[model samples]
Target: MLIHPEEILETINMVTHEHLDIRTVTMGINLRGCSHPDVATFNENIYSRIMRCAENLVRTTEDIQSLYGIPIINKRISVTPIAIVAESCQVDDYCSVAETLDRAAQQAGIDFIGGFSALVQKGMTPGDLKLINSIPQALATTKKVCSSVNVATTKAGINMDAVAMMGHIIKQTAELTRDRAGIGCAKLVIFANAPDDNPFMAGAFHGIGEPDCVINVGVSGPGVVNSAVRALQNPSLGDISECIKKTAFKITRMGEMVGKEVARRLNAQFGVLDLSLAPTPAVGDSVAAILEAMGLESCGTHGTTAALALLNDAVKKGGAMASSSVGGLSGAFIPVSEDEGMIRAVQRGSLSLDKLEAMTCVCSVGLDMIAVPGDTSPATISAIIADEMAIGMINKKTTAVRIIPAPGTKVGDMVEFGGLLGTAPVMPVHNFSSETFIARGGRIPAPIQSLTN
Candidate 1:
């Protein structure tokens, strides 16, 4: 069978003109067998396993990119969460493990290596606590290692104590990398209902249940959707939704095709295709721009949330039609630093922390890439996260917090992380304290909505 000419041309236009591309092709490797009684042997085994599994990853992806002429932006790896795998070891910290992972990633030409993480939705074990404590040092020392902590899930409810601790951890991470405007915080994500097979970094982890090895693809194209929305002549909201759905279908088709090709080449199981409208720092490629094209005065205006909900639902519908293997945080991301339109909106007073939180209720993830004041208290940060986690629990959806306390930076200051992470303006937070409420360390019971059984 031959490729359809019209479809081929359409894809070319999407890539060469509209900025559609495969955001990441991540290899998920199970490292359970690498665990050993001796920490040194354990580290060696871990490194060797990763290198063996992903040795050809970068070269294979490059070959596929040339073969298909699609831009595969990042080649990454997600391993089994280090906490569980390293639990038997007597080491006090996982910093050495993080270094080994970083070295392995560099050798394999991986852009980011995820799974330095812990799951403490209900409570923290010794391993979990150690991993959490070591995160600041681990992340601070490594270049490519990404970290995440899941402190809440829908059924088990929010872990307020862990939430409180992460606030301090985030601050410490920021301080550790303060010379770079706390860019380390950008690599750390705290989650409620975080997915296992996500291809995106700062949150990607090969779940304990996932296969030994698999390839997951992240497809991104906020620009294409923006163009499609703007192409409609005086379109209504319904028209815009249909347009977005159609665009998402096309983008996802490109993703599924690329992912299959890459998996076939790499001899790996094809995992999910994450169709998130993840924006870059580039001018035209922005999720917030797509929102603006949908007749929003600004990204955080009254109808912005409704418009986002529609866009998100329509994108999901379209992507589902294109592929059955859709997973991860597959929705439009509203990260302030990552999207130029979002940054502009914040700079112009059209968006704020409250409005972003409101928007997250209807989308995937929460308060991503938002920069708060330097002096923002850890209790306050924890309170912000508690509110977000509650939303996820009640709605039975995934939500994450990746806010940065830009050290020595206050409101109206701009933090430059550069490249794909972009830059963020320090947005104002509510001065009122949530101190006492956050200090009351206890689990918030799962909402009735979580009782789907």
Candidate 2:
């Protein structure tokens, strides 16, 4: 299947308001074999295996970009959860492992490394506890390292202990590097039903069932959708739906071509095309821009909800029609640091944590790229996670929180993660405490909507 020159140009015209393309195509690698009782050997094996598996990732990605003429913005690696492998090691070993992974990514010329994580929703084991405790220093001292803590799942419910722990960890991470606390948050994600083969960071990790090597494509085009919506001078639901369908179809076609080519180069099987509407710092290439096109004065206003609902539905409809294998969180993202529109909204005092959550009800993820006060308590952060998870559980959609508690920073402070992840101004959180409710710590039963015939 080839995209004709004329067709490609038309799609380009609709999408490229500026120079933003798909941001990343991450490959998740499982490293269970890297575990060894001997700490020194364990570190060596982990680094060597990752280097061997990902050595050609960057080169292969470069070749595909040249061939397709579509800029593949990021080349990243996600490994198996480190906590599982570090079970036999001491607490200090977490830093060594993290440093090794960070160096490997840097050596390989990759931008980010994910799966420095622990899955403690059910409960924490010795290794899980150690890894969790090491997060603050592990994050502060390393470059290119991303972390995640999965504290809830549909089957297991939420782990209040883990949730509370992560809240404190976030604070510690911020305090360690108050200047870059928001940057640390950009590398961390809190998840529910987090996918194993996700090719996006700060949440990607190799699942247990994934093959030894495989290629997955994450295709984004908020610019395209925004342009389509902008062209509809006087729009109705039908008109808006049609525009989204067409734009998603074109974007998926690009993803399909890229995925096949990358798989061919790496000698690996091609996986799903993630039709996620990921945004960037470029002008007009933003999820917030799409909202503005829907007639909102700015993002985070009352009209933002209706605008996001329309944009989300349209993207899904279009993507579903383009590819039968649509997976991942294939919807619009409103990461504050990453998107220029979102950054501007935060700076303008237009967007808040609550408004961000409201938008997540319709968009892809929840409470993404938000920065709060450094002194915010762990229970409060857990409360934030609980609130976001409630949306996912009730709506039966995947939602997550990636909040940054910049240490020593308060409302109105700004922190930069740099590069594609971008910069963000700290936003305020609700001052009230949710300790009593969060301390209750039990499974929130499945919503009534989840029950069927």
Q: What's the distance in Å from true for residue 329, model 2?
A: 1.4
Question: What are the candidates' C-alpha RMSDs?
Answer: 1.1, 2.3
Q: Would you list the C-alpha lDDT of every candidate in the order shown?
A: 0.92, 0.80
Error of 2 at 395 (Å): 2.7
Model 1 TM-score, 2 decimals = 0.98
Worst 10 residues of 2 by lDDT: 11-20
Q: How high a TM-score does candidate 2 get?
A: 0.93
**Between which residue pairs do clashes occur in model 1?**
none
Model 1 lDDT, residue 124, Cα: 93
The 10 consecutive residues of candidate 1 with the worst lDDT sum are: 444-453
Would you estimate the TM-scores of all the predictions? 0.98, 0.93
